[model samples]
Target: MFDRHKSTPAFTRFTYFTFTYFTHFVRSAMTAFTLIILTFIIASIFHGLTGIGVTLIATTALASSYPMSHVLVLTVIPCLLINLVVFLDGGRIVYYLKKYWLLVLTSFVGSFIGTKLVFIIASHHLLIALGLLIVGYVAMQFVAMSVGKNFKLPNTTPSLVISGTIAGVLGGATNAMSPLLVMYLLSATEYTDDPKTELIKASNLCYVVGKIAQLIVL
Candidate 1:
């Protein structure tokens, strides 16, 4: 008869939740699952129709409802998967891989370094920075295309090499590097209006190269 009805610890009481706790957990999980599906649908539509990067569409759509950090991680899976699907189905992978060898090698090297840096920095700011960069790059490209005026900003070799490096590094960090990559590809060619297509091509080639290198090194 020492303690037939001893009181439970507050922590224990909380851990041994009643029916209400599980109900709430299930409800929250269902809500999150629905939101994820919605975001994926919107992102897929945007990418398929306009060839815009999936990360851009997915991040913006999920930003309001989901934590930015979570969205960023989820974004990478779809982006990479979509690319893999396109590569396997379209038959362009082999051709482009051989064509843009330098861009591919440079991106891998830069991305490897960038990935390490990302682990050291805070997560919240990463997505915001990437979003802003995308918006800004798109705006600039639109303006250039409208004017249809050739502005000799810099030579292609140095600019491509530098931008590819930066894109790989930033892409590795935030998974939103497509905007920067697109910007670099646009700068390489005179026609800014057609950057989305060109950027997609460049990215495909770079990804193939980077993956091969990663396989070997890692």
Candidate 2:
């Protein structure tokens, strides 16, 4: 099925270039796969410790190959599955929901609005917004770490609403709202004593609720 032909200089050059391009593509794809695996491992560890970071880490890793919008969608199933595991593991879902119903409801509404906006807004603008939100989340986390457990927002309706809304918007836009929810939970007075446990519980709940809202809206 093969025919032999004399190779010209141009043909030689084309063959070399094609091989080089193929090699590079293979290497790049392998590198991305390896990084994604590593990111998943690290994110899982962080999730176990803090009930957050899986979406953020996975998004950061996969953004190399996909658009932010696609990354957000790709993360939904994984986030929902992981959050469900965490939420069930933590147990007492009813108690947390009853205690933080306002936050949950506000977050759901905010997420609903955010999901709608994601469809309306330009992709580049959404990418810009996602980048800013991630940076802000990192800064807030740093501040919380430096300030310690004593630094807390009042556990009032307004605070909960604001935090939940912000979390919902970010979550809806990027699927990376766990950090904000964790921050809000950690800073709330209700979780002051055993913040780690409460943080995991509330953060997982928020993530589950946010992911569900995104699923419905998207």
Report the number of the highest-lDDT candidate.
2
Candidate 1 regions off by >4 Å? 1-17, 63-69, 145-155, 187-199, 207-218
lDDT (Cα, tens digit) per residue for candidate 1, span 51-89: 555656666677656555465456655666666654555
Looking at candidate 2, the ten consecutive residues that score lowest on lDDT are 1-10
lDDT of 2 by residue, 42-96 (tens): 8788887866678877877777577766776777887788878987884677888
Candidate lDDT values, in order: 0.63, 0.76
Error of 1 at 74 (Å): 1.8
lDDT of predicted model 2: 0.76
Native-to-model Cα distance after best TM-score fit, residue 164 in candidate 2, in Å: 1.0
Regions of candidate 2 where Cα sits further than 4 Å from its true position: 1-37, 144-151, 189-193
